[model samples]
Target: MAEFNSNCSTTSDQDDSIDIQQLMEDIDFDNVYSMEQEINEYETDQFNIMYNTDDDDDDDDDNGTIEKSVTLKPIEEQIKSEKLNPLSTTIVNTKKPMTLKYIQDEIEKIPDYLMKRNKVFKQLIYETLTTMSISTSTNNMEDLRKIAISIYKIMVIQTYQLLWAAYLKSGMRQLIIPSKTQRAYSTMLPIWPKEIKLLLQADKHVNENETYFNFINAQLHELDDQLKQNQMKLNIKANHFQGYTLSIQNIIETYIEQHLHCLRMEIEHKIELIQYDYHIQILKLEYLRHKPNTFQKQLMKELCHSKYEQETTEQEVNLLKQQITYYTSTNQSFECLPIAHNSLIDSIQNSQIRQQLFLQYKDVAKQSRAKIFALYMKTAKEQRDEYKNKHEINLKKMWDAYNSTSDNDKISSTMLDLMHQRCMKISEYIKCIYKFKSQSFVSNSKS
Candidate 1:
């Protein structure tokens, strides 16, 4: 049992030792990875500075000369050698004299090749050598060192490839030679390194990109505002057009209504004229049926004659004769004796006798005139009384006739009712026309 326990303890110790060794290997690998990352970062910063310096050199010839003078060939050659043998142990050890500053200067000499492959290469390199540092020994230290150097060389080669790729992408060779704006055009290319140093040194590129984006956004906003304004204008114009159309419609309706009203009034007037003419013709026919005298017929014919008919007929001559007869009859005096006495007195030559005769005649004439006046008044009163009695009787007869519903009376009443209805219809039509006109006026006023 003790032998079994001792064997288990020994196995446990070996396991613990293996675990410790694995832990140490893991630590060393982590350290080496971190160092590689730092070196890559440093190289990146150096390339960025080199790109920025190239840009500055484009602006000023003196700066360009100064940058060229500082360039070291030894470091450039060493970096080139490292690129050629990235995994070779001999190159890394042989190039041990190369410093960080020399490496930075050397980066400027190489053209950018892996311009868009930096991140991809970094990730691939990290993943490819997961267990890079596994053994821990005096002999393994050299191997470890070679591994570290090889990693550094790989980083350097990748950086050089990136620079070369950028240079190819820039199409610098395609630019027009002997052009004053060539330097400015070259600066516009997006082949520069994006490290922090270049970002800080070439702030103008960042500013220009930001400015371009801002300008685009502003233009979009302006276009949107213009669209909104155009829409509002269209709406306003549409409203105006609608209002104009309505006004035109209303005007047309008003004109139509007015024309119709004028036509109606003309038609009504013509109807009234025709009805008057018919009434006159009917009355003339009734008079003729009642056996009117020649004189009465002549008068009515003359009254009813048109202007042309009157000119051709004997109405003017008859009218003149009637006027002459009326004047002759009006001129005759009623007292014959007074006229004779006046003639006799005018014939007397003796003034006193003439005066005595005139006085006696005046007294006699005055007494006779009084008697005639009294007789005339009595006759006039009797005639007036007779006329009043006749009028009353006629009125009573008319009332009885009106009350009685005889065939003739009924016919007359029916005719009268029909005429009344016609008149009422005409009045109602006029009222309707007036109402329509008033309503139209009210609507127009509101509009």
Candidate 2:
């Protein structure tokens, strides 16, 4: 990294004032107005110098005046000049109308200060540039020269720019405080310059005790007058308040008395109401206490009945247990199917008897199924009759709604909606009928 010395060293106290004063004088009004023009001209000149092919050397023209052309010195000489004084490059006067001779004279003194103050910075930049110029990455001498020239130009321009900024800031400071000593302006800090040395430099703090004591004394007197006026106003207000106190007290007492009377009446009424409610509650409690307890008798009866049932269940359980013990003692096996009697089951198990019993069961089942079918048909007919009645009611309602509306469009839309609802109900009824038929078929197959 190429680090430029941004800390522009201050000159002697005498030269400092002269430089600041000279700079203030040299800052022409025209220069402020034509600042853009100056920048543009400087850029054009630099561009011309970079690519100008008319480098016919410095020659005398017909007017006997020497014409200056673009020229570059050898790198060794340039390095030597830099070592001697880096800012030795001719300062181009960007402004044409404003003469910069005074500026030049003032600037000429800066080199010594910079040299003495920034010796380390100079050595760093020199070493960096030297390393870069000699690096193997560079293609040729021309590139190295260009790089060195650009770096030097940048360093000088940045240094001057910083100095100019500091100058302007100090000038403005002096303008604001003309009593500021030249030594103060000279040692004033700059807007630029990021070096550690600049931070370490002590700044002179300007004592602000410039006749402010008189101003403070004047302000104190004004405040005392204001305090006195406020005291007078307060005394007048107190006198006025004292005059109003008796009437205000009477008004407050009357208002309090009125509100107290109203509160007393309201409290009496509330107390009466509360007492009446309390009496009513007492009567209700007495009545409830005297009322018949039939519900309690019923609960007792239910409890007694549950107890009897429980006792009977226990006795029955005991009897079953006794029977189970008797069977266990006889070594009889437990049957999964409940049969009324073993003898009856045995009788049915005989093949001829079993066939006869099966035929009898079939005949009974057929009779029961016929009765169930007849009942289902009767219920279905009743349901169909109810559906027809409901459909007629819905149609009557639709017609009523249609007649109630005078708008033809509303009638038509209402009719369409009603028809759609009717269609949906019909489809649902059909589906139910289909389900019933399917159930009948299933039952027949099962039989």
Candidate 3:
């Protein structure tokens, strides 16, 4: 009975050990399965994040409490499919090498807002290439090295091509045409070369690449030559414009001089007539003082019998009216003569006779003064009219000449506008060239 109890206990212990081993095996299997599922989910998330894609079904699955196991192909197969159908792929498989065209397309795909974001642009390119190298097969270092070299070459070529294309698109060609006739006159000066120099100073990366530096130096020389030619053309055009302006100025000056000369002559003629009239008045007054009676008798005879009798009578009446006006204006007595003329007479009868002779002489003097003044005014008006007519004729001639020159292709407005456009384009082109050159330098340094 004691032997039977001991054997039964050993058998039970053996069964317990077997059951425990089986349980351990089942737990290990479950853990491995759970780990695989987790890995699959992580990979799916990576794909969605890298490719910037989302699936509605995936979102629903993620939200659910239940977990599902997924079977996945090798990383290489997945990358190949992504490369073959890039648009359809939900992940960026960086194992594939990027072509020059691909790089160019990527650059073009960058938004305009991102173009000036130099750090961001460089970071994107760096991350893409680094990811590609990391994702490549470990056993294929040789292939990886080749791919890296190809990427460097692609970067250099793409940068150069982008800059060249920008230059072509710019209107630099308009500034320096091969044909002289087609060459335009630039009114605006370009500061692009100076701006490019400043850009180069700010970014020293391009100077590190010998090939890029050489190419840029050659282009700078070409651009300098083109700018010099444009400046020369502008100078010539400016000179021509100045010549026309000077000619117009000379015409205006000559017109002013002629008008002044006419005015001076008219003034001199009026002065001479006034001087002659004053001398005649002085001589008549002297004759009346020396021989008043004789002078009076002669004056009366001339006034009564001369062919200008009516004119003489009118002159006498005007002189008498002037004497009356002077007496009234000065508040003087009409019975007395003026003080300066009082010495010329002796008695009251003689004074009366002398005053009559003086009044007749004054009438002739007044008439001469009125005639001279009228003649002077008429001459002045004629001179003014002549000046105006001549000035109009000169102005018309100038206008005709200007219009004819402009219309007949002597002055080219289109050339001026084209040159201004070209100057602006050159500035833009310089900026693009500097930008790409700096990018190329950065890419090469990293490689």
Candidate 4:
């Protein structure tokens, strides 16, 4: 047997595999606005400076060899930002020598998710990988490298969440992205580098064990406060740690603490296409227990079942209406109903599908559910039995009472109208059951 690959991520976001959602978001999140914002700000500042400046010249045109002056402080600050990057300490993202204006464009198209709401979630996941590292960790370079790689996965997901939250807040949800752009639209979930980071960089090495735990707690406290203030309305899920064994290192811990986390969240399932907003705590346990494979299976089942019920019920109702017409055309002079009418209802009621329906209903209780299914099952047994039994009994009773003078065609026509009435009632029954079930589900949720 071929060995199965165990490297599949719970989310396509994790593995940089085929995350269609990420692909779609890539166009949106791709920082496309940095240059515009910067240009506008700079122009405004330039106008203000030019207006306020004093010029003393005996001859305005003749005395001037006019030159534009660039400020050293702002440029120096920008240079420092480019020099020492927090993301990559080794060499920085100097693939192209970018000015502040260039970086501004990156920020505009998409706000850096790594810089926003997702930071906390990334930290939590990173903490888990850190905890796991203790068990699988090696003192050697290779294991340290693997642990760093795992941390990158956590960071990538955090970036996705951050950018998504920023988009929601931007109120650009309905700006119809042109179809051509949408085809290239994918979410941006970039992996942090696999390089091992030194948590302590050029800080005085304090060999105090007590200081380490306290420092982590202090950083967590600060982050918690920021999240509570700025992120009162987001749900953030993270892999939970059992016991108090996990601890964060210095600067990495401090950097994460400064970024705010959102406690209120509007959660959406891509496959289920269902959405609801809830406090993060309410879904925290559920998120921790998330099994992607099982969720996909459950979503498939729900969609299939809903479609099957709708199609089959429509077919059955149409079949009954057609049967009313079929029986109407049978010989009128005989003044007799056909044996086929009773046989049809009886065969359908006893069929495998009907048995399955009964079994499906049998499992439901009237406690919290009050399922519409029970109503359907109860009605099927009663109405179907009535139709079959009456067809059998009335055929014999009417045959004995009637003479050849009776217009059997007219009588059958009356029966067809009656069947039409029953069909209407069945349609009403199906709708009412669905309405009742919806109300019950709402009530149950509130309770």
Strongest candidate by TM-score: 2
- Please give the clash total of every predicted structure, in order: 13, 0, 0, 27
User: Residue by residue across 1-447, what tens digits does model 3's lDDT show?
Assistant: 000000101122122222222212211111112222222332332221111112121323222221221122221232223321111223222221122344445534533322324454334434443544443233233332233223333333333443433322221222233466543232222111111222333344443234334444555455445445544544454354312233332432343344334223322332222222222222222222333243232332222122111222232233323322432343433224222232223233665655654454334333432343343334334433543454445434433433454443221333233323322332232233223323332333233
Q: What would the per-residue lDDT of candidate 1 be over residues 85-198, giving only the tens digit for each residue? A: 111111110111122344445533422222224454333223323334323343433332233333333334333333323322222222223467422222223222223122
lDDT of each: 0.31, 0.30, 0.30, 0.27
Tell me the tens digit of each residue's lDDT in model 4 across 1-447. Answer: 001111211231123223222222211111112222222222222211111111121223312222322111121122223321111112121121122233234323322334324555455445555555633223322332323333333333343344333322222222223376322213222111111001211123563223433433343444344434323222111122222122432333334334312211111111011111111111211222232233222222222222223322343333323322332233321112121122222344557754443233222211101222233234434444544454445434433323235443122332333222323333343333333323332333233
Per lDDT, the best of the predicted structures is 1
Candidate 2 lDDT, tens digit per residue, 272-318?
22222222222222222333143322222222222222222233233
What ranges in model 4 sit over 4 Å off? 1-156, 159-170, 179-373, 376-447
Where does candidate 2 stray beyond 4 Å?
A: 1-352, 405-418, 425-447
Off by more than 4 A, model 1: 1-350, 405-447
Q: How many residue-pair clashes does candidate 3 contain?
A: 0
Q: After superposition, how far is residue 92 of candidate 1 from its true place, in Å?
A: 99
Residue pairs in clash, model 2: none
The parts of candidate 3 lying over 4 Å away from their true place are: 1-349, 406-447
